[model samples]
Target: MKNYDKYTREYFTPPVSSLKWTQKEYITAPPTWCSVDLRDGNQALVVPMNLQEKLEYFQLLLQIGFKEIEVGFPAASETEFAFLRTLIEQDLIPEDVTIQVLTQSREHIIRKTFEALQGVNKAIVHLYNSTSVAQREQVFRKSKAEIIDIAISGAELVKTCAAQTDGNFQFQYSPESFTGTEVEFALEICNRVLDVWQPTAQNKVIINLPATVSLSMPHIYASQIEYMSEHLNYRDHVILSLHPHNDRGTGVADAELGMLAGGQRVEGTLFGNGERTGNVDVITLALNLFSHGVNPHLHLENIPEIMSEYERLTRMKVSKRHPYAGELVFTAFSGSHQDAIAKGMKWREEGNGPHWSVPYLLIDPKDIGREYEGDIIRINSQSGKGGIGYVLEQNFGIDLPGEMREAVGYRVKGVSDRLHKELIPDEIYEIFIEEYVNITAPLELINYCFTHRDDYEATVSVRMGEELKEFTGVGNGRLDAISNALRTNLGMDYTNLVYKEHALEIGSESQAVTYIGITASEGTVYWGCGIDNDVMTSSVKALFSVVNKLHHSTSTQRLVNNR
Candidate 1:
């Protein structure tokens, strides 16, 4: 903060203002994606990927549906040259995909780049040189005209080399650091390079405008792109491309806005991996299109698998919070967020519409190889009754009643808080079983038989601590009759006995589960669950479980009061 005055805005706005890109609402189609992972991304790595890793990463880019990939700056290193040769010699490059190689504006580098493309079926000869004012004044110490000459000479050499080379080639020119360059000067340099190539309809040239340092807001970049798109030479035969970096953490925004400004192609890395803050994340850009109902044309159905392969090959970890591919992107830990997600999922399941409009989720996790259980509703201390209940119903087919879920949620949250860890589905199930299901301590139902008399007569065998006894009572129903018998023989006074039953649909179809809730004299309701092959037996067990819970709660409270 103290040195804030030391830095000033270095980006140059276009002389002519064109904000037409603002009228467009969204990108109706995905741009032509060119991955620079092997080149820009590898150069930034602390330990550059080996030959084998580059090969594997290239294959991965192919699988992700990149039509054009900048393999590397072949002239920069023997390893880069070898990797390009390996792709060509081993016939690893797919017919539909075009491999690109970066080169400086020098003649030898251009010639060496062409040499690396010796037998390639199709390739793009990418030529670049720094054109920003900073580079002109400090780095290259050259005038704008001299910088333009460098790009033109490189374009001429690349053109001559392509004519002599055996491979099919296209020309690409980048005014490196285009964002910091004056827009008028940037356009002039690109057009001069285009003059040397004279690209045709069949072999259109790429004019890449890279925000090499991301010196301004996204709108300024968009305006600069629009100016170039409108004023470029051989406009019909030029492909406007954007290569944005993440120095300002808005690479994705810059790419999106550039596309909206008539830029056709994008050159970026998989997860924004490159020099410094990294390149624009192609994954984020493509998935952003996908979320807006546009087909990104990339096979991203299994993001986890892609992330694993990327981390393994690049030796870089994808952050757990990374968009669409992170481990916790779909997980909800907040109670309110979990509740909304649970309810939204239910609403969607009931045929709400064809659209994915779930609350707290931009897109369905299952659409990208993630599931609801374990991934969506994570059970932490901040979890709510809705999410807990939804998790139970989805994973274990044990749907807690609406009134009972809150009490169960509190108990589960207490356990998780004490343990200081998230509860897995199995752990949550175990907690449910230990705390609420078939609990028998002070009162246990050893046996029960029912007979139909005037109003459902019941004979029940019960155990209380060390004593076992038999009791009989009649009520309108079997569970009521049993409750009446228990209340009379055990001198337990309670009312409003609630019971509900459902057949277990997950592990055992034949087993029936029943839930019971009883209100004590103090207006507190204790809940319990029971599972058995017979519905009547499960109902009786459930009643006993609730009675035991009530007795334990009362005893614990009395002890606390005495203390």
Candidate 2:
């Protein structure tokens, strides 16, 4: 907070007001995306990618549907020039895609840049010079007229070099550090360059407005773009492009608003990898359009694969919290969020709507090669009954009853809390099995038979703490008869027996699962589950499980009270 007065606003507002971009609600279409990963991104790396790595990365960009990619500054180094030659010599460049190379306004760099494209089918000769006031006063130490001469001479040389070269060429010019340059001077310099090129519809030239150093809010950049778009000499024949840096962490915003203000193309790197804070993240920009129902015109169906390849080739780790592609972006750990997501998934499963409207999710994970099980309802100390129950049902096909899920939730959360870790689906399933399913302590069924008289009659042989016995009782139903037999024979007291059964569709089609709930005298409900080939056997086992749970819980409570 100290010495804050040293910092001052460096960006310039246009001489005239241009507020027409404010009326647009959203970007209706995706911009012309040109990836600079091999150029700008590689230059920022600690160890630049080798020829092989660049080749693989170029193929990846092609797969991601980039029609234009800036390969590198050919005159920068031998490696840069060789990489371009490799792509052209090996015929690695696709016919529909164009490779671009950056060069300074100097004649030799322009000649070598064109030399790298000797046999290329199609290419863009990108020319740029620093035009910001800081570069003029401190770096170049030249007047505005001298800077304009540099751009014009470079444009003339590039046009001359392309004519003598053996490839179809397009021209793109950028006033580097355009953000810190005076808007009027920026306009004048761009118009002067256009006068020489005289671009037409069939041969449109790109006039790139770069926020080489982002210094203001996004609206200011948008208004600047609007001024350029409206006042450019060859407005219809020029492709207005934006290349925003993320020094202020708003490169994506600048690009979006600039597009809304009549910019037609974007030049950025994937994952925002470039100098300083990095270029605008083309992935974020494209996916933002996608979330708004516009096709980003890129194949992003498998973000995980793209991230893996990007990391492997570039040696850069995509953060786990990165938007849309991050590992934890779709994971919900909060109890309330988990509950809503679980319910939303169920709602979606029931054919509620044709569109994806799930709670706590901006887009469906499955649409981006992510699964719902581990990626969605991850269980920790903060998990809720709905999320835990949803995990059980989705992973193991064990749907807990509505009344029973809260009880199971507490038990699971207690284990996770004590262990200080998240429980995987298998671990959660094991906990369910050990704590509630077919428990056979204090009361166990050895054998049983049922008969239907006017009332159903049942007889059972059971074990209780190393003792075996037999009992008989008659009730309105078979399960009720078994309950009556146990209560009478064991002198146990309970009421309000609840039972439900369903076929076990996951592990075995022939097996059936049954759930039972019984209210103790102290007004606490104990729950249990059983699985067997026969529905009747499962139901009887479920009843016994509930009785065992009740006995153990009471025993533990009494021990605690006595202590």
Candidate 3:
């Protein structure tokens, strides 16, 4: 018979289809989480987060509903030891939040770990060892009995230490490569350790089973989890934990499978930053439940705050395109996506019944701390009539002519292809106002320039519509100087209109297109578009356009700041 470990690594097939479980099979449970940021995430980082950063992160973890935070290995480094000491001496560990420390099964290191948490109010000593065919044969070159002895001796040492400690101490043991280990041998070692510890329902022992080096297909991993779920003994007195790595890029699926197969606890870092392809992402898992109409213990709404704190502490920029927590996760750029999200949102707002739009949205952005209302994100050209009309309908309640949406779609495609970037709201507004809304003749900007020396200030020149209306002023960069020149010539803040530049093209160096929207006393939406090689010109043209929009809207519409 082929070793299932070797066979499973090569090919994995699901034991059953997802449809096998109905709605009744899906039950949300209060999850026990353990963040491996310090140990797992730190090792995986290119430049590891320092002690102070780790301390800040530790506090942030507590602020979130994560009760079990696995701090770094105190036995590893002076920095880790000092940070652990600071965490202990500062007396900051919450009553509910129990600090967990990881150590190898070795006696010296385990004692050093215990020494760090000596006075700490609450602590869990997590001890783990590699226990798989490959690890035993290659890593230690030890037989199965020899490996079990290593683990058993480690647990016995922990029991002795726990008896010695005055403060609250619990023991956690992980069969490091549990997913790939032989089931009967794995159970034997687990039951051996459990017998030594004598864990009860109230005093539950955590047995974390890591998919250490995720080597199986997603379904194989799921089957392994289900098989283990059905086999692991002391079912009531043990907290079955899962720690999956993204070696196969199926860590998320692996976690879902484990949970489905009856895992009560999960241990991972935020965004799954760890060794190799990293660990399973905890944030994604919890929010996945939130999308499925089930609640995860982790608050879905405090995501931004949590991310902000993590960023501040870790000094690592979360990619803007990262799911839910990213800057643009909810933003739709594709025509179909924007159109679908828009129509879905409209249907969602209709309070007559339950929503049918969860198709486009895998998880609701509201589950995380995002403020996206499914507004159709306009880009240069990849938009259809639905998206363009939606934007027009949103900005101004005036519905554009049907043919105009088609024309606008073509124009948008042209712009998108030319710009090579997503078109922003103000940019779309500018194009619409220019092409559709007939603004007879407003402030026409002819040309502008700045002449300045190394010692003195700068000058501004503007040619307004064939009429060379040039104003020379002295100030900083051409933007402020030009604005001052405008105030001097075009009158004061009587318009009560503000113009903000929204980028038409993305990238730091590329020209950021500005659309200036202004309001009138009567109320209207006037928009202008300015594209230039120079950013100052763009800013000035944007202001110039806002001045036009304010003038036109006041004449035709109602007031300023209309949605």
lDDT, model 2, position 182: 96
Q: Write the per-residue lDDT of candidate 3 for residues 75-138, one digit (tens) a residue.
A: 9999889888998888878888888899889999988888887788888889888888878888
State model 1's lDDT. 0.89
| Candidate 2 wrong stretches, greater than 4 Å | 375-563
Q: How far out, in Å, is residue 375 in model 1?
A: 5.8
Superior by TM-score: candidate 1 or candidate 3:
1
Worst 10 residues of 3 by lDDT: 14-23
Candidate whose lDDT is highest: 2
Error of 3 at 300 (Å): 3.0
What is candidate 1's lDDT per residue for 163-205, written digit by digit as tens?
A: 9999899889999999889999998888888888998999999
Model 2 C-alpha lDDT per residue in residues 1-563, reported as the tens digit of each score: 99999999999999999999999999998999999999999999988999999999999999999999999999999999999999999999989999999999998888878888898999988899999999999999999999999999999988888889999999999999999999999999999999989999999999999999999999999999999999999899999999999999999999999999999999999899998999999998998898889999998988877876787678786776788877678888898999999999999999999888999898888877876555455687666687798889888788788898999999998999899888999999999999988888888889999899799899999998888989998899888999999888776788998878898888788988899999999899989899899998899889999999888888899899999
Q: Candidates' TM-scores?
A: 0.68, 0.68, 0.65
Tell me which of candidates 2 and 3 scores higher on lDDT: 2
